[model samples]
Target: MAKVTFKGNPITLLGNEVKVGDQAPNFTVLANDLSPVTLENSEGTTRIISVVPSLDTGVCDQQTRRFNEEAAHLEGVTILTISVDLPFAQKRWCGAAGIDKVQTLSDHRDLSFGEAYGVVIKELRLLARAVFVIDKNNKITYVEYVSEATNHPNYDAAIEAAKKA
Candidate 1:
């Protein structure tokens, strides 16, 4: 498991850590409409999965917005922002932020994505900050388990990987 810290305090993460070159794990997360959005739904498109603890937080909000802005130029890529926030809150945040390009999905119900990606923070029940870039064939090409939960991820490298895919 990757070492992670929240607010300078070490937190234990649950599940197996994923690495580049591995097959991307499939997880069912709820879209803003409360409908299930699975990895299979994104088949045939390069995907940038931005995992955050919550959308209401500053870092998570910025990360999602950044991806939304970049999505316009990424012709064949799909950007997804997964968080443990409820569907209602996620939908409201997207509406207020005018975030259309990045699909904001909620993992509160099942924690499927969090557990599968080894990002679930046992103490807080929130996901640690991470970034994953999966190719159209569903192979992970880039993986970043951010050392600090509150910090932003390497946007450039993740974006470049998606572009290449």
Candidate 2:
């Protein structure tokens, strides 16, 4: 498992750690409408799966917004932000933030996505900050598990990987 910390304190992350060239794991998450969304739903396009602990926090909000802004320029790439935040909160945040390019998914109900991605922070029941770039064939092409839960990910690297994918 990748080492991670929250606010400088160590925390345990649960599940398998994914790597580049591996088949992207399929996990169910809830869309804004509370509908189930899985990895297969966007199989034909490249994807940037942005994982954050919560959208209510500063770093997470900026991370999602950065990806949302980049989504407009990355044609054929689908950007999805997954967080344990409830769908209602995600929807409300997106609306208030005017975030349209990136789709926000909720992983609060079951932590399916979090567990599959090996980003579930056990101590807090939130996901560690990370980013994944998967190709059109559903093969993961890039993976970044940020060392600190509250820090931002490598936006340029993630975006570049998505473009190449």
Candidate 3:
């Protein structure tokens, strides 16, 4: 179980999560079009798995926007923003935010994506905020599961790691 704080309240998560050097877990996430898009389909490309509790929250929205701005410079990589939000909501938010560079994927239908990555908060029905960088070979090279939900992650460091990945 992973332990993190939500507004100063301790929250314990349940699962054995993926770590750096582990074979990244595969998942089928919903796209904006409500189509099933599998991680395997995006193989051979560097990936950034931006796992968040919810996109509706202030921190998550900021994170997505930050990554979207940085994504343009990383020409051959795919930035995937994931949350438990419905695909329709993800689509609407992306369109409203002008979030084009990052691909917003949903975990509403099933949380296999959350469990596989070990970021699911079983108690809250949310995911632990995390940023994972997977290389072209599907090897997870960098991982950061935030210890506090209310806090934002180190975007600069994550970007540097993703660049290396």
Off by over 4 Å in 1: none
Give the TM-score of each candidate.
Answer: 0.98, 0.99, 0.95
The 10-residue segment of model 1 with minimum total lDDT is: 15-24
Highest lDDT: which candidate? 1
Q: Per-residue lDDT for 35 in model 2? A: 96
Summed backbone clashes in each candidate are: 0, 0, 0
Task: Write the residue-wise lDDT of candidate 2 on 17-37 in tens digits.
Answer: 999999999999999999999
Model 2 scores a TM of 0.99
Question: Candidate 3: how many backbone clashes?
Answer: 0
Better of 2 and 3 by lDDT: 2
Per-candidate Cα RMSD to the true structure, in Å, reads: 0.6, 0.6, 1.1
Worst 10 residues of 3 by lDDT: 10-19
lDDT (Cα) of model 1 = 0.95
